[model samples]
Target: MKKLTLILICIASLGLASCKKDTIVQSANNLTIIKYIEANQWQSSADGFTLSASLSDNRIDDRTFEDDGILVYISRNDGNFYEQLPFVYDVQSYSYTVSKGRIDIDIQSSDFQSAIPDKPTTRTRVKIVLIESSQ
Candidate 1:
């Protein structure tokens, strides 16, 4: 019985000593930028008003182009709050589209083709968020 106990203890010690741990850590980053669009900066498109801004760099690569995320937000009250697009407020609808190098924001009346009664007469602040994903 004593020899059997010693043998079991040695086996347990060997098992614990031989155990190995392999860990991999991955990290992801996100980039945020702010752009101010003056009332006059909103251009007229066939559908409605449009605002365009160039990205700081063509930061998005092929990896991001396929799986990354892009978010566009607008502040109606001096940054106190932000509303994400495409959102409908009052009677105007806001939306956006992203490309490799630029972003375009569009606003149209709820009626879709009608002119917005409150076309932006004041400057507007816009927030842009780019998600860089890693695995």
Candidate 2:
């Protein structure tokens, strides 16, 4: 009876040590659409063309754009038929920057014309979408 009580006490001690409670903190996943500009005209210029759009919510400026997160997507479509255009050449390049509550986009007009020869004029519609997330 004494041996049995000792064995049960050892088992109870081991079981109590094995059970532990820990506190875990989780962050909220929030993704917001910072800006959405549609049907923006793509014009021709000597040094390419530039388009600027303001962000609907300036809350993104409060966080670090690099660490927090920022995604920019630009697409072109035919104004007449509203069809998506495929990139043909590698000569065309685009650069974008976000400051304050506005985003500026720069595109090479001559390069764009060479890439999409079908509708190079004012018949091209550009759309810009900006997404931001806080992690």
Candidate 3:
């Protein structure tokens, strides 16, 4: 009888531990940057591009960006991107490179963090832009 009671207690403890919620927010990493077409002209200007794509849990897909810093990674052959001056909240500019078709905006929760006004305690939203180089 004592052994049975002890086993039940252990089981309950395990259940409670497993029930702990994960608070770590995640963001997108893999992004497919599409070119904007207007008047038969591809709008690839610096000011013409926008990273208005929505992110889930601060993640883009498989990419992670930095807040107030620069992150560079390879998405594909000559299809890499870079994000700079990102924030946990508010509208910020993150840049990337595109060659063949479209650019991708990859973001990860691990890339952003709170600074200056104290580390943010909640998830944040970020904006990005695609820039095609003439080089």
Candidate 4:
């Protein structure tokens, strides 16, 4: 009886040890802007315009593009929602990156020229949304 009780106690201990729950840490930040930038004229040429945003306490430099991701959204008005844009980090394209507390964005006018025609007299408004996440 003593040996059986000892074995049962050992088994219970092992079961309890194996039942330990895993602790997972997760955090996320979302940023939204209505008409972050407005331009008197919309151009359709490369390097015609540039836009940027600064995010504080985002720890962006520590995140890898693969493991972590940055999501971007843009719209011409404040009401309609647009699909998320694919983020690119390259030399020759509309690209963006985050480091420390600042997010640097380069927008190519030619990419959106069709959507936004080159109209000198018309006013253009742009809205942006940025999402950051970590685990």
Model 1 TM-score, 2 decimals: 0.65
lDDT of 3: 0.34
- The list of candidate 3 runs beyond 4 A from truth reads 6-19, 26-36, 40-97, 100-135
Q: Per lDDT, what order, best first? A: 1, 2, 4, 3
- What is candidate 1's CA lDDT for residue 32? 82
lDDT, candidate 2, 1-135, per-residue tens: 999999999999999999999998666554534233444433444433443333344644655444554545544433233221223325555555666555554454345555332223332334433343434
Candidate 1 colliding pairs:
none
- The sequence of per-residue lDDT tens digits that candidate 1 reaches over residues 1-135 is 999999999999999999999998766688887878777666666543443433343765566667788888988644578899899888787788776667777776767455643557776788888787664
**Highest lDDT against the true fold, candidate:** 1
Q: Of the pair 2 and 3, which is ahead by lDDT?
A: 2
Worst 10 residues of 1 by lDDT: 48-57
- Which regions of candidate 1 fall more than 4 Å away from where they truly are? 1-26, 46-57, 60-63, 77-79, 112-117
Instruction: Kindly give the number of clashing pairs for every candidate.
Output: 0, 0, 16, 0
Count of clashing pairs, candidate 3: 16
Instruction: Give the residue spans of candidate 4 off by over 4 A.
Output: 1-18, 28-30, 37-39, 46-70, 87-135
Cα lDDT of all candidates, in order? 0.72, 0.47, 0.34, 0.46
lDDT of 4 by residue, 39-131 (tens): 432334454454433334344445533345555454433335553453432222344455554554444444543332232232323334445
For each candidate in turn, the TM-score is 0.65, 0.40, 0.19, 0.35
Q: Pick the candidate with the highest TM-score.
A: 1
